[model samples]
Target: MALLDFLRQKEFAEISALKNKLALLEKDIEIFREREDRLNHDILSLRNERDKLLKYKDVSDVDNEKERIIKELKDAKEELQKEELESKDNIEKLKKEAEELLEEIENKKKQVVELDNTILLQDYGMYSPVYDFADSEMYKDRLDAIRTEQKNMILYKTAATCSTNWTLNGSEAQGRVMTNQNIKQILRCFNDECDMLISKVKFNNATAFIEKIRKSYDALNKMNSKNAVSISYEYLELKVQELQLAYEYAQKKQEEKEEQRRIREQMREEARLQKEIEEARKDIEKEQKHYMNALLKLDKQLGECDEVEKEVLLEKKSEIERHLSDLDIAIKDIDYREANKRAGYVYIISNIGSFGENVYKIGMTRRLDPMERVDELGDASVPFKFDVHAMIFSDDAPTLETALHHAFENKKVNMINGRREFFNVTLEEIEEVVKANYDKTVEFVQIPQAEQYRESQKILKSLEIS
Candidate 1:
């Protein structure tokens, strides 16, 4: 219905209306995509160029000379005994610094791909694929045999997007073992708003969802997950009770001190001998003084943790709400299958670095559209018209997709289909990444075997409950 309505809302006749708007956005996406490709080319070229440019001036080859110098340095150091130490001491700092700088530069170069990918995603949303898909329905009726032609058909309508209700409550998807910080990062994706919003989704593909998880984890590894994870509300509530109790104690002490001060002031003028202080009065006063001091000290002690506690929980209701909102957004359904297309061959590729036979090349694209993806990544995506390495499709379509699963990780999550629901990744997320990344490979290896029956029987005889 949204697809139909959206198409109706647009005026296809106008050049600069909705259609134009979508087209322009696509154009922009294309430019970024092309730019990304150019940048990648530049990076590759620079990598090769740097290798050649490592020559030191006046030396035949800086690398060779350095090797010679290193050998001589090693021999001389052996002779001096302390030479090795001096060499290590002299170069370790420099080596460490060089490595760090190199990493920084590599990060900078790679950033172009990241930003370009983001831009491509924005483009998909602008030119939503819903309309395109809806326009692809091919009409058909009873067909004819070779002997007698039955009928002919050439009607077309667009495809439909799958829909689901929004009854997302945070607790259902609540994950365990996730830290407070991990949850916050996932929450940020939902708009950085301070409110709890939770939504459930039906993912299209489990593999794609896992891919998303891998990507998200890599992006937010340094972020703290503890904050987002819900501690025992019971425990926190208990802590609150403790806080309130301390607060009460402090207030009572403060009041008691005030009263004692008044009493002491009232008795100040009378001479020590003339005013024979009642033993009871003195005892009461002494008790009041001792308690007052103790209370003050306790107040300060509790005060020490005030900020830390507040931060841990301040507007926590609000924080949890914000996290829920993030979850809702993270679980949005891309459902690329809904998109209708005019295509020759389509290859949806993930990290193909390790899948050699399954992979054509290690290529990266900043765009999601097959056409723009082709233009951006160059030959790998569309090496030759008919020779498409692997025709593939992705679950995320119309709108660009990102890996929020990785962004959230194993705090607690239920990945239904290709969508993430019920939990945040605030725990040992990397392990989850590795687990998910190779999920496919692992599944193939772990399938139960027929020979395992004999092995199982032997194990049972050894000490098993058969």
Candidate 2:
């Protein structure tokens, strides 16, 4: 029994140890579960931190993209500013060029205007005197010399040109004959054209005629171009000069004719004045003799009369003495007029019917009665009477008239002929010139009483109305 109890205790001890080992193993399992839960929590926190880091990186990338866009915009702005400045400079250059072109065009227009003015002046017969001469005679002498030179040129065969060694059929003599004939024909044609144009040249057509001559020369040369025929330059220039000389000569002749007419009129006027003075002197002498005879008769009556009759005879003798004194004064005045040949009246007159307003004729007359000359001028020569603006008696009337003419030379009615006494000027302008030239106070009739002209105008108006 004792042995059975010992074995049973040993078995019990073994079973208890087995149970203790199983308990320890359960504690270790619980520790391990706690450790695993802690580890899972740590892993989840790390994962959340990694997600935060990735979000930060995405924000940085967006900022970098924005900076890049701003840099690109800045670069584009700088380029645009540069282009703007260059465009402005180009615009300024173009504007300057346009202004310069406008200025150049204005200068060209002014030059054209000046040329037109010159051409107009030439057309008005106001040539710039190509040849200066003392008189028509001098011009004639110059023309003769020119003709002699031309004749010499023609005689020397220098007036025309042609191929000197021209040949026909290889014969030198035949070629010479042909060349001579051709030269003669060409010269004759050219000379005839120049002569026709020159003869027809006047002041108005002189430029056109010269151009025609030049054209004719060119045409003839062109027509005979193969032959190489042409007029000499010197000969052509001589012909042109002859044309100008002929025109000037014609003008000079007209001036000479007018001058001769003036001289003849002056002589006639002087003769008339002399005859009138002589007649007046004879009349004065005859009147003085009659008065003296009456005085003698009255004196004899006074010597043989009663008191009342003697008183009457004495009064009559006194009247005759007064008449003789007046006659003697008249004779002295006549003598003074006869001695002073330059003494005359300068008259300013206007014929409104024949000439328009602002037109006046200034003239001088040596007549004792200046009105007589005025009346003669207002006769059949004019449609209406001349209204006298002023009649000034001057010791040197010719000088006064000439001075007035020179003062108003540009205002003359006939610009070509200076002998024309008519002037286109206002009355005030004339008065001012008169005051400047004349030392004495000159009374001018400011308003012209064109009675005949005004009356005729009224009558014409009435006729039109009727």
Alpha-carbon RMSD to native, per candidate = 43.0, 38.3
| Candidate 2 displacement at residue 386 in angstroms | 0.9
Question: Clash totals for all models, in order?
Answer: 40, 0
Q: Number of the top candidate by lDDT?
A: 2
Superposition TM-score, candidate 2 onto the true structure: 0.70
Alpha-carbon lDDT, every model: 0.34, 0.77
lDDT (Cα, tens digit) per residue for candidate 1, span 80-119: 4444344445455545554555555454343222112333
Runs in model 1 with CA error above 4 Å? 1-80, 113-132, 135-185, 190-217, 225-466
* lDDT: worst 10-residue window of model 1: 153-162
User: Cα deviation of 173 in candidate 1 (Å)?
Assistant: 18
